[model samples]
Target: MSQPGVLLDRDGTIIVDSGYVGSVDRVEFIDGSIEAIAALNRAGIPVAVVTNQAGVARGYYGIADVEQVHKHMIAEMARHGAHVDLWLFCPYHPDGIVQAFARRSADRKPGPGMALAAAEALDLDLAKSWVVGDSPSDVGLARAVGAKPLHVGPAGSAVDNVDTFADLAAAVRFILGDGELAMVTRDERPVKFPAARFHRADSYGGAYVNELARAFATVDLEQVSRAAKILNDAHDRDAAIFACGNGGSASIANHLQCDHLKGVRNGTGVTARVLSLSTNVELFSAIANDLGYEHVFSYQLQSQARPGDVLITISSSGRSPNIVRAIDWAVANGMHTISLTGFAGGAARRRAHVCLHVDSTNYGIVEDAHQACMHLLAQYVRQSRMTPDAVASQTF
Candidate 1:
């Protein structure tokens, strides 16, 4: 019989995420990580380190550098009497800068290529195995291979409905079935975002522009792609896409209605249907005055939204009561939920099916990024229906 094994994520799980760690000198193992591996080794369970090395594809480092670091890792573990049966890393990304490594590969995290290879090489049973990591992609990799998933991150990081641990040691204990190490439940509270990034700049223009560029770099293109697909699906089915937000986010939500409706319909084959819950002042004021302020969006959703419609909520803090309520309502009613969140994505981020998160603490930066996202999605969906020649010739 093939034996059960464990698949472990490298950075942020077994070691600290020092950002594209390419050299052995920067390898900093997490506390208790060595002991945790030793415990697994003692139990006669095979372990494999499966990681995504996007740095290699991004031209930050080469495959040789990655291999050297892996070798260093293996040596470090050996000195401590722990053994990792296999080491696997995926070095491909669709938007990578290195031509040799740039392109999509099934070996990437959330893809089953590496897991399948490890299972075969190690004579293991994936159905009985555990995949532990600190990111959503790690959980996704587990699901893709039918393995048990354990998250190792903060109290409320966005990958929902999975077993979470404070660190790798705790996750290891759970995998070993230690009775004292009970699984930790997610707090589901709003996480605190970092301090302001542009406050200390020498000049306003330079600081603001640089901060915006940095924040934009952290935006997940994959999440945006998923959200675009959802919007397109709704458009194809002739379902209304509802948008809501408050203050600056409200403006973005209102703008979304314009771009998604008129902007996407001009040359597109489909007629887009969109509504902004934040735009109707008379009805919104009545709902806030009568029912409650938090009921503004949900109340509208209940009356107009259908099962297959889409809800897009924009919130800088992501914890606005009304926004959270609307997302919950839409999800419960079978409508697709997408959220644009910044400053430690809160309940709305967690509840939404797709979260386009802006990793900025400043409200202006977040709102600016959200506006760009709205425009990108509208244009993408618009051009998706047009011929390449027409798209090239037409003004956006």
Candidate 2:
């Protein structure tokens, strides 16, 4: 039944004991106590509160008043994003004057009845769980139930199997593991390609290109369909679809522009708004000469992109600085970015919201697959826009 641990004691353990804490205003949580409980909850552990209230027997407060205080505790915990699963309290006192509450019951503390009842109700594995309380009686009860007992108070009484804690918060942290609270920071790793290892003999060729094309043909058709729909929607709204790439990938970007803008709307009433960022030699040279090569796409995107427009970048290695910069700019400026890449899934692949990774090391194969992806999306959109009657009437 996936039985997990956590047995807690109320009053001095969870809340500051204010003798008959009947009023909602009197309820207060110990420091870091709520956060520790929340961490246990996140780790899929169940927690229950087992407390003894002698106030009911002393006539200081009734069971209903105790319930009201519990209710207030639950509300306060919720506000702090922490919640307790159950509350089990023993209100009986053996030497009290009230006839109904005077009897010594097994459910009263110093006996493990309350803890046992909580264990049964919560379906807990008692051996794996620990109990936290401020009193020696609380420790005795925990020990009787075969559970770990943590004593939270100044040193005084000697308990055999009890661990001493300063407060409930410290006890909670001890049980959940303290090292998890340390802050962790991460920086993006630089992309490194082994250009020195490769010679002209290992360059892109027919075999490599064919292998890449075959891999591309296996891309999930559903993704292509969805991308095509997004492209078509933008086109219908007169929004631009910008395509970019590096080297062979640049050629694929050019091809994507041709198929999407020319092929898709060849005979249809719809004309797609498409632009290949790899195109325009003059602008590329000017940007490379003035702002440097890495800034070329970023510069163009700054001037052309708008909110809701789409930017698609293709890269075999996926480490192209210009492409990554372009994608970052587009996304930050509220444009959707998609990447098509290969070779261990590079920076661009990770940066793009939707990545079509070609699981191949060969540049030729990756570029070919990328080109096929472009054609597939464009063709799908074209076919989708065609009426059934129009398609049926067309000659083979």
Best by TM-score: 1
Per-residue accuracy of model 1 over 148-211 as CA lDDT, tens digit each: 9999976877477898988887888787666633222232211212211223233345445545
What is the Cα-based lDDT of residue 181 in candidate 2? 38
Q: How accurate is candidate 1 locally (lDDT)?
A: 0.84
**Model 2, 117: alpha-carbon shift in Å?**
2.0
TM match of model 2 to true structure = 0.51
Off by over 4 Å in 1: 1-23, 26-202
How far out, in Å, is residue 100 in model 1?
33
Each prediction's TM-score against the native?
A: 0.53, 0.51
> CA lDDT of each candidate?
0.84, 0.74
- Candidate 2 residues lying further than 4 Å off, grouped into runs, are 1-4, 97-99, 155-161, 177-304, 307-396
